[model samples]
Target: MSPTDILRLLLKNWKLLLAVPLALGGSLFYFTRHEAKSYASETTIYTGIASGYSLTGNSESDYFRTSNAFDNLLSLIKSRETKEQAACYLLASHLQLKELDATQLSWASLSRMRALLPAALRRQLTGPTLAATQRNVTAYASANDTNELYRLLNSHDPVYSVEALGKVNATRINSSDLIKLELETEDAAICRATLALTTQVFLAEYRSLRMSQTAAVIRYYEVESEKALKRLNDAEEKFLVFNRDNNIINYYEQTKYIAGEREYLYSDINKIEMQYAGALASLAAVDKKLAGRGASLLSSAELLRQRKHLESLNTEIANQQLFARQQETDAAPRTQQLQVQAAETVLAIRTTLNDHYAQLNSVEGIPSKGLLDEWVKNMLEATENKAKLEVMGRRKGEFMAEYHKMAPLGAMLKRIEREIDLTQKTYFALFTSLNDSKASQQNNELTTNLKIVAPPFLPSQDKGGKRLMLVAGGAFGGFFFVAATLLGMGLLDKSLRMPAVAQAQTGLPVLGLLPAHPTHPFKKTKKPAQASKLRDHSYEHAAAEHLARQVLRRVSAVPARPFVAGVLSPLRQEGKTTVVQSLAHSCNAGGLPTLALYPEGTDAGPANDYTRYYSPAQATLHRWNLAELTQPRAADVQLVLIEFPALLEATYPVTLFPELSLVLLTLKASRSWKPTDQQAVADLRAATAAPVEIVLCGVARYDSTDLIIPIEKSKTA
Candidate 1:
């Protein structure tokens, strides 16, 4: 449907639009007029759990040195135990009453009993200091002899629970240290008191928890430090005992001494080895000389005596020659004689030595001096050298034995020294670690990081107003309800209510349209003439005039005599007769000669009168048979609008269409158009060669383009 048709539909049903909104909105506003007022209070605290001071070194570091502290604090803040305690605190401060004689307590009774408590006791019982008195009072009406009512209040349930925690909200602010606690309740004072109580209770719990956790951490450090200290002491004792067992004041120093001695012994052994080699070489040389001396040649006692005498004579002669050469007289006779005597003694000694060998016949003549010391004096010197060489060889052999024996001690000394160094390092490391742990434990005992910043204060404003919200919500809901209903009804209603729809559905042109005119539904007992006079013309007149002009445009196309049009609908009471009545009046008013006829109605006044109307129809109208309609029409009649019984109701309806030049299918525009209407149009189009056109009657008044004025709903009906 077009925008114009929708507007007309709304305008025609103006009562529905007005009634739905007024009924829904008015009823909502009235019932919700006295809604409960609420007041909200807020308090804020910051968690020190995320950041803290370093007690050990005081550089503002993470003192707890743990991952769980921050998480634990957040859980503690929102835990059920905390909420229950907060609720108890609130009750103790604000609603403490005498024992409940009844299952439920009244405010008046509470107020009366509240005066009996001492001021100090009341002050002490509120906030973080809530006493055992509150526990007993709250437990009075509890189901299991526990304060389950206060617990109920602290639950997250929307109803049947205490709303202290239910109405309260706790949350951490984004990217900040602050935690916010908000409480909203119907009673302003109660909400304010609850806010104070909850924050105080939370702080109290926080302080206690912090103390306990800190103490636990300190105790752990102390125990660990003690263990480390004990380990250090044991290490020191082990080191001391090792030194004692080794019989050394300092193992490290003793190891250095032993190392120095071992190095000295190694140097001495090296010198002795060189000396021993030299001694061995000297002994070999001495042995060679002894072999040449032929000690065996001197083995005989007689030879030994001769050799001794010769040695004496040679020494005396050598002394006399050395004395003569030292004399001042160069050519002295004595010097010459001494030289001659020395030569003579040397020759005699050799001759005697050779004679002895010759007498023994045991030696051959000796080789030259290069191969042997041929002088008797030189041979005796060689014999003495061999004796000294043998004594030195024996001494070297003893020293070598000692060098080999001390070689393994150097390795044993090095091993002992390494072990002593390692023991000292272990003791030092343990002592240092133990000291650090002790300092940490001490610092933990001395430091505390948690501190409260602010307490809860009274709220400045109450809760949100309900009346405006209710009114706005009701209007919105009512609008949606009406829209949904329109949608549902439109989905169910298949009738063609608009001209555009009828044309689109039937595939026929709507030549013209007349707004629906509900006949004077009020005059139940009126005669035909009286009812006709009473019918209103505001919508009907304007609709008929517009439709008749449109119909004439098509009728004028034929330019034939007796221009006759039949008006029909598929259903009874679809305003076919109304369309004809208004159409003829409209034609006559437009200066066209017109006659309106109802082919089957007996209610046309005065038998032959076509100008007089019956009970419900307005305008001069007449009834005719198919014979009268086909046989003759007034010579003055330029247009004749014939109204037929509805197609579904008419018997012999085919005979009524013989003289028609055009067929106008009239239907109420406000009513749903049925499938039968399309069939009826199809039938009429098939039955005659006349052009079939639809004229929708009773369009509503909504726009300047809408051709029909809307008829008002009866005020009484």
Candidate 2:
């Protein structure tokens, strides 16, 4: 279609385009109304940290920590633990969980309580599973965020989802500043109990954590002190042993005595050695003389030599005796010298060994104050007997120093022991007192430091929004659906709706345009048999005749004298016959002498002389040859409407009628009637004996109105 044509079509069908989406939206709204209404009431809770307990000096850290801490607590409230706790609390008060368990519980049973709870309750608790269908899924309220308390309350059951224990359905309603805790059950009292129990549990948990923290600090310090005391005791024991066994005491004196003893023992032995040597010399001389006397008596050769040796030995023996006599004299210088030398050697050795003797004579020589071995033995004996008074006295002094230093530890140990005893006593007392206080608090229903700022109120109607939003949501959904449908239709459309699109494919000028009828001609109907038959006849007769009237009118309006109008399109079934008849009638209506002609087919076929409506007064309608038109006719018709079917024969131009005002060809909009189809019409125009104008017929309509038309009855009848 041309841009003008497209714009016209859009303008005409604007309501249809909009209605599709609107209807979808309406349907969505209608269906959503069946869903249950959820209402919420919220009470604002300002959780504050007390003055003395905070460390950041009124900073938001306390609030931040509280928010974090409460997040876990809030989760715990909606947890199965909280559910069981709530159920137990309710049970304790003679209220039953049978109703709640039946409606709100999941279908899965807890393995821990499956055996304990009744079989009916087991069915109430369901294991989480994927939804079989998309619609069966339920939404969840976030357990971490505590800004809304109603989420906690509503989240306990799918009938409602909550933000917190005391706040429920706040997101679904107005007046959001308040944390509304909604109880969705039919019972009002149960809702109140659930809220109250949740608050009490939160307080209990907070206090328990506080006490544990304080006790942990004290226990950590006590353990560290115990380890320190153990190390200190070990150090003191080591120091005591080191001081008593001082290895360096009297060391120099004992070394000196040892040096003196070594010299005396070695030097005294040299003096006696010289006296023994002299005695040995005198005995040698006497033995030699006795042997020589035996030798002198023998006169043989052996005896003569022996006598000579004996004589010499007797003389030496006398000299040795004299010498021995001199050496034996105490006053003899040599003997005196020897004695003195011995004495001097002994003295020198003693001098060399002086330090050794001093060591021997030192106090270490004393039994009580001896070397290490002796002292150790003695100390051991003394300790066993408790008899060495001096050793005991020194020991007492050493022990006293250590004892004094360690005395504090002993006192501390005793103190810690006392503290432990006291703590044990206090622990018992505190435990008893705490139990009593707890009992009293429970009995009195005392308000804890953690107070509930706002109690859950019974909703008048409901604090949440109603089903209108669902309707709006459905409307939005419907709008998208319609848009999707239109976009899909546009995308899938392959038929040529625009002339430019066809021209782009094949560069052919659109010679003429046949707008779609105000009403669509081809559509199924639910009319009665008579009405259908009437409608069919009207289309065949009146509608066909109308086309012939338009054809004649177009031919006369051409700029050239006696202009020929050709009705043509891309394919068949585009009402060329109808256009031709309509044009003829239009010419006749205008009081012009007109003739309707059908082109002759080759070989004298049915196209050569096809009969149209017979008329006695007006011009006869007949198939005429191209050769026959060039020749003169019986009368000079001012207007001639030619009806030509699209033919693809090569000899079609030769068969074209002569003196043709215009070549009129017709084809359907569907099929392969592209720009090439226009070439067929252009082919006839080129072969015409005269100038030719092309006219298109049978455009399809987008609506029913475009295809309907009024019927015209024949006046000649």
Candidate 3:
């Protein structure tokens, strides 16, 4: 079929196609309104390190290495711990636990508990059907008792699903970082509360874990202080034992030993004391020193000499303290080393002192022996006690040196210790607080990390009420459906829908078109009103007639005469007779002399219906019995259009219309001309021995131009 024909068909059946989408869309829109409204609430979570420390070195570097803050936060949102908390919160607040308990009570007992027991029991129970015993009981009730209870017992009952608004339903949505949470409860306040509570608990739990690292640091310092204190005590005890072993007391023996063993140390101390006296003397000697030779004595080199002398004196004092320790342990290595070294050097000096003493003793003529011994004993005992005191005094000096060192470090140590102690206490206290917080928070709930950016709210108005969607969708679907239907119709249609196909089928020059009318042929009218009718009473019926008459009017240009136009079809029932009648009617109506020669072999020919108009239509209607054509009856007639059926019996009767212009007739979208029908038209035209112009009949309404092809215009002679 031509595309226009296909479009026309779609236009014709548009309503049916439109009906499907309209019905479906309307039903959908209507049902959607009745659907229950859903509400949603959400909370956001931000997980992070709560520790505020920014320490340096290995400790600071290692802190972030093992911590998986991002991953742990992700896990926290999906954890069953969170879900269980959520479930418990929802169940306690929204679920129908109380109603469940109510349901557990026996129905009979519940009915009996109320004063309306018998009446309630009758309503709760449904009478059975299809049982003889039950039917008998029902019949007895109907006959004997006509009360409300009787009716209730007999009536078939319906059980309704409880309308509990507190049921909770959880739904998770599509974001990985966020959860689209929803609870099914009628109360909007409850939904918001549930979400809020869940979030609070989760934060409590999350913050407790946040400070764990800081708590660990505080605990470590407490452990180190105990170890340092123990080490200090052990060192002090060993030092005390060494002091007791040596019989040493004061610094006097230490000073004597210092003077005898190192003479330069004593010489240096005497020189320092002398310089103090000299500096006083130099108070008046500056003017004398101002002279060239005296200036040399006050030069930097001279000052260095004096400073070295003063440093030697301080060294001598330090040696005196060491000497006291050695006096008690004279036989010990510390003492023996000092004595051996000093004795070797001082032996020469002692020999000289002894010679001087021996000379004195000789001059005194040898004192008594016990008096010398007693004097030596007194000196030795006094020296021993002095050495013991010196030993004690040196130890005290050592302690004082250590105290000086410790004094500076002591403040630092105490500060560190205090910090360590404070940190330890904070660690324990914070840990304990965390535990307490966790226990309380275990019952408390918090929102998950995922939160809905936009919670579902009760809309003030539904988006378009779905009606506009219904209409638009209906229109779109209907358009496609109609297009598809027309496409299918075009493919399956075997009848010639285009004028070209009709020409190809029968070798006819398509002359005209006739539209199909939905109205009866007699009831048709003009115009937009014409779209409603089943049949065309005016234009369509006259179309074929007008086409034939126009062909006859052009016969002078034809190459042959006794022109014959045959309205024909491949099938017997194709509307060929109707075309023939319409053709004859137009010619007759136009005042053209026309005779519809009805050949007798087939009752299906168009002239059979026109028999009443001709006086000799009945007698000469048989095959080879055209008495009117042979008679002198048509000399004045300008043209004649014949009705010849495509029959085998009529194929040989061509002599009556010799030198004839043969025109073949067909209807648009009607039965196509078969091969035999085509051959019959060709044989009749060829047998007439004439040039024939085939005429197509009844092309579709839009294709009148295609029905006729214009011949070339003649030039002026």
Best by lDDT: 1
Compose the digit string of candidate 3's lDDT tens values, residues 1-717. Answer: 667766666665667766776776676666666554344444443321232122221223234442554346545544545544443343223222222232222243233323432544433332343233234333444455575334433333111011121222333333222334344432344445555545554555665665454455435444544444454455444434433443323234544544453453345445544554544454444333233432332344534443344333333433554555434434355445544543443343333333333212322344423223333333223333344344444555654564454445435444545655655665566566555555434322232223335544432222234455655776677667767866886677666665677667556666554445411222235664555232223445445444655666666566444445644444444454555555555665567655555445534333332332222234334433334543444554545545554444324344444534554444446555567766766665665654444344334554443443322111122
Two-way lDDT contest, 1 vs 3, winner: 1
TM-scores across all candidates? Answer: 0.63, 0.46, 0.42
Residue pairs clashing in model 1 are 152-162, 153-162, 495-673, 496-673, 514-697, 514-698, 515-698, 515-699, 516-698, 611-620
**Candidate number achieving the greatest TM-score relative to the actual structure:** 1
Compared with the true structure, what per-residue lDDT tens digits does model 1 show for residues 75-137?
776676666666655556454433543222235434543554455645544443336656654
> What ordering of candidates by TM-score runs from best to worst?
1, 2, 3
Ranking by lDDT: 1, 3, 2
lDDT of 3: 0.44
C-alpha RMSD between model 3 and the true structure: 18.4
Q: Kindly list the per-residue Cα lDDT of model 2 for residues 114-137, writing each as its tens digit.
A: 343355533433223322111111
